[model samples]
Target: MSAATVSSVPIPSRGWRNDMVAALFWLLTVVGVLMMTGAWFLLALASLEEGTEQPKALAAGTTMAGTTLWLGIVPLVFAHIAGFALCLVATTGRFDRARGVLWAGEAVIGASLIGLAVVLVLSGGQLLYTPPDYVP
Candidate 1:
């Protein structure tokens, strides 16, 4: 057959879910960076200020926001990591079944991560600094 006689081949397209997961991956990564930067700035400002009202609030707020942001995106990252691990396993095992199980595990991990974040926020946990009630 000549080059001119060749026909075009069909291209495979990804599903909406795959597209959504990709978007979330990029979005979460960017958000995580921004959140961390803002948290650092707030914590620094809180340290620089010599006050009981604004500085204390800044420290607490940054701690909560930063922790929540980090916790929220961690499972999404693990999900991707798990997906890669499954890909390695798929070299020998049943890809379809393994992918389903890995995705389900990711979902559970994501849900639990969210719940943990909510609990942390509600509990008003602090980090990088000590509470006033501390003896040290």
Candidate 2:
């Protein structure tokens, strides 16, 4: 075989699920950041709202609630992380099994991301800029 002869690259067989999972991984990554950021902001605002003196007291309580809500995403993040591992497996030559895991993770991640988005939005409280009378 000459150097010019090209070797065939092994392509991972992707099912609908695998594609979906990969999509979810990306989607979840975005949502996770948003959720975490929103949580931090809420906590910070609580500190500000309480003023300099009782921050320890106020922050503590709100932090607990935020943490409880934030904690819900851990498993989904883990699954999505594992889904990435499965994707690596697909790259390395295992497509069939990895695909199933990847897609399952995708669904989980997607659902979790959506949940996080919803939670984050709810947790965000009312939009401060808008007046009570304002509706559009």
Candidate 3:
């Protein structure tokens, strides 16, 4: 009599779906990062301008612009690093953990971008508009 043994491999259900989801997350995060970079650059350039008539407005605008630039860049870098880490975990067959990380990173990056946009819009009045001069 002869004995035989069979080995079973773990096959994930809907593996393609995970792949697609991860791909989409990466794509959106990449685009967000690029836009953040551009926004930071523009903020820096605007902060360098010296044509504002209102000294208080100019000072406030400069500080807000610098803060917004840092806020955008730091979150982008963190998101990128987190995304890469999630990819590594995925490759190791930890799909669940990877998915969770992807969502967290996406949220962080999204919030950062939205915050930057809001800051830019709110500061536009002080930075882009000139105030009327009044004799003191």
Candidate 4:
């Protein structure tokens, strides 16, 4: 084929499957980050002094956050991590045009995990700040 003819031919992009997988990965990542933030807020609420009065809405939100964190977010995060690992394995030696998007998702997950750890530590410190004799 002539160079002009070859150059004129459309180049095939990555398959729809890759795009779909990447989209799902990113959606899960966003959900995970939002959940982590909610969990961190719950931790902050839980660390509040027992005697401190909180608004009814704040109290209700805390309960909801705790429930969702335990029942939804935790499981989802675990599954997401597993899915990411599987994707890495499955894509081995394959040409992925969306590889950069996957890498960015990985970075987001790593950063969120680190932030969650920090929130946990800070909450722990706050919880432990009360005196032994302190009572609600």
- lDDT winner among the candidates? 4
Each prediction's TM-score against the native? 0.27, 0.30, 0.34, 0.36
22-80 in candidate 4: lDDT tens per residue? 56655655655665555554545543532243344476675322444454456556655
Worst 10 residues of 3 by lDDT: 45-54
Q: State the C-alpha lDDT per candidate.
A: 0.43, 0.48, 0.51, 0.53
Clash pairs, candidate 3, are none
Off by over 4 Å in 4: 1-17, 49-136
| Counted clashes in each candidate structure | 0, 0, 0, 0
Model 2 poorest 10 in a row by lDDT? 125-134
Number of the predicted model whose TM-score against the real structure is largest: 4
**Superposition error at 29 for model 4 (Å):** 0.7
- Candidate 3 per-residue lDDT, tens place, 16-97, comes to 3466666765565555555554554445344444224236656667423344345444555665565455444433333465
Q: What is the model-wide C-alpha lDDT for candidate 2?
A: 0.48
Point out where model 3 deviates above 4 Å: 1-9, 12-17, 49-94, 102-136
Residue 6 local lDDT, model 2: 75
Give the alpha carbon lDDT tens digit for every residue of 54-104 in model 1: 446576774333442354345445544554443333322223455545544
Candidate with better lDDT, 3 vs 4 = 4
